[model samples]
Target chain A: MTEKGSAFLDLMGGEVFRDGSQGVKIRLTIEPHHTNPRGVMHGGVVASLLDEAAALAIKELLGLRPQDSGPHLLVEMNVSFLAAARPGDTLEAEASVLRMGRRVAFAEAQVHRGKTLIAKGRFTFVMQHD
Target chain B: MTENLSQLGIKGEAARSPFSGFIGNVLEERRPGYSRLSLKIEARHLDSSGRLHPGVLATMMDSALGAALRDVRRKDEEGIPGGTVAMDMMVLQVVREGEELVAEGRLLRRHGALAFGEAEVKKRGDGTLVACAYFVFAIGRGSPR
Candidate 1:
């Protein structure tokens, strides 16, 4: 971790539910600050959670601890927004790794607002080795 | 200051708001079907790994293209509000401090009320392409806010 990083995740606090084979689930609350001028949950918030989940999944797959895993940059991501979500809503994101290669890893994730699928995401990351 | 402009939540002509302003996104140039936005890379824009976060790039790319959706049609069709309903992005590279990313967008096509746009994020100085993205916006006449 760098000196000026991790503030966004820290602020938008969430819980990680480790799964046996399906990967992991990250859950967080949609707050006012997470909304746009339209007063709904921002898409960027969803993307952030999706990206975070993918990174963590890759880290776990590589057997690297969170603090020791180091930084992994995103190579690509495709997200499709299926529904809109608002503040006071609890959001959950789940990721399932498709392929974890030596250098690149791919994971697919989805965001749900209490059973209503809000968005689906596919992310690719460049694995970091320090 | 301007009445019609206030509908966009802009005080005068500045569309900068709490969320976007906080993100430090600036609309450098805008016209019908096109827009240019830039953000100065900072520590806050970085992720836990310290490199610039993909979420920030995704947000910036979406915002840049979405800003031009209003101009996709004729000027007479004003008062239409919209937001990114979907987006697809590819990160070509990454950057850190001392670098600024510029997102430029242009309309790709239109599907009924939704407008599709393509954008590219590049370093402001050396013009190194960081990421490219496409956005889909849901727009229509909404109650005046």
Candidate 2:
């Protein structure tokens, strides 16, 4: 499945792809606007990508459609920046669900530039049901 | 020296980073060990459900934390050179569009080639805490200005 129509995601220009029973992947090309003063991708952008990927993984794990389910609130997130990604680089963020409970879910994601790991994140989300 | 610090503000040419500018982060104040910034929620800052996006909050917190460290280091005769290595953030309340939020960051400590900081995001009107975050940064030697 391909995710679309999120204003914030559109602003970031990420392409989402879901693999059957595996997880979700978000692909983004580093633009000049994404760079920080050091001319590399901003750490916050990396964190955002990690968070989104992880959240999407949880959504897939529960088999909930975006429109049908209630909003999933991100309770906590931890990100570790391993390396810097420069402009013009293509980074792919892949995520998987670690555990899913009745109301809370745990997921993790890693951003990579080919073999180079750029960042990783773990997320805790409160899954609301309608 | 003060001019350089002022350049980090919204009216100055140096302002924040490109990403910060793109996200409409406005630097309100910066001083030793502390920094303040604000952002007005827009349509582009919301998720599909019309709620404030977590990524936007993370961006604000990350920028505020880094700015606090940068403010403190600006006083050194050398220059400021560093980057965020890790961050942990928790959302205390959910925000929505049209809410203006302010983030205040405080540098907690600096050790050998490392710095620690924390930040709080609050609603501009009622000062309700929206989020809190902690950051770890690696300090280096370079010409920041």
Candidate 3:
């Protein structure tokens, strides 16, 4: 796996890795600050991880760096939460691009803890070129 | 109108999710089937492109909707526990750091243990719609986790 880095990914404390294929994976350890009142991982954190994973996958598929491309805007996303993640649990999200067009892209991502699927998401992004 | 979390009868620590606190979302109002929250875009909330990250908007939407549901549920006679099941969101516009955005959530309906809600995010001053979302929540699930 090859490591990739970004400012938002770093702020979220997730480590991104390319699986030598079209897929990208992001792993994050749940922290106290990541939890909701019920002490489970916040839904927002889950969504953020899924979004980042899918965005990275799209970036890798296009082979475009941030500077090399125009603005990449997330146009739509649908997410389903299947289970709850608690503090101390390490969650990993894997994503891959489903389709790529001249100005748009589609992707899907699943977040898991071990073998348990915690959440899944589908994303659409509008890509621009300079 | 700005309101304190405590004024909404939400216990500070119990109602304030750590992640929400980390992001600095302030509760603006809460009533039966409705809630509003505001966030100030900061450097940390922006992506490499200097625009507010969509994920940050998602977080706010989820929290705002959940708060709306929670408020209504607590007023219910049963007071069942619930959690978010699914959400669909569309981002129509983007904001930059130093801007303030407000999210308003409203419970649309409830059937048995299922509740549906919608949220809209807008620029605080001009009320320009930034994003909108629909959410599904499962009540009596004994906590979302």
Clash numbers, per candidate: 0, 0, 0
Ranking according to lDDT, highest score first: 2, 3, 1
Query: Per TM-score, what order, best first?
Result: 2, 3, 1
Clash list (residue pairs), candidate 3: none
> Deviation in angstroms for B53 in model 1?
0.7
Give the DockQ of candidate 1: 0.49
List ranges where model 2 is wrong by over 4 Å. A18-21, A65-70, B1-14, B74-81, B141-145
- What tens-digit string does per-residue lDDT give for candidate 3 at B1-145? 3345534322342356677767778777877788788888888887656677778888888888877776555335244545678999999997988999999999998766778899999999999999999999876433331
Output the number of the TM-score-best candidate: 2
lDDT digits (tens) for residues A40-68 of candidate 2: 78887898888777766776666755322
Which candidate achieves the best DockQ against the true structure? 2
Clashing pairs in 2: none
TM-score of model 2 vs. true structure: 0.88
* lDDT of candidate model 3 versus the reference: 0.78
Query: Which CAPRI category fits model 1?
Result: acceptable
Estimate the Cα RMSD of every predicted model relative to the unseen true structure: 5.4, 3.7, 3.9
Clashing pairs in 1: none
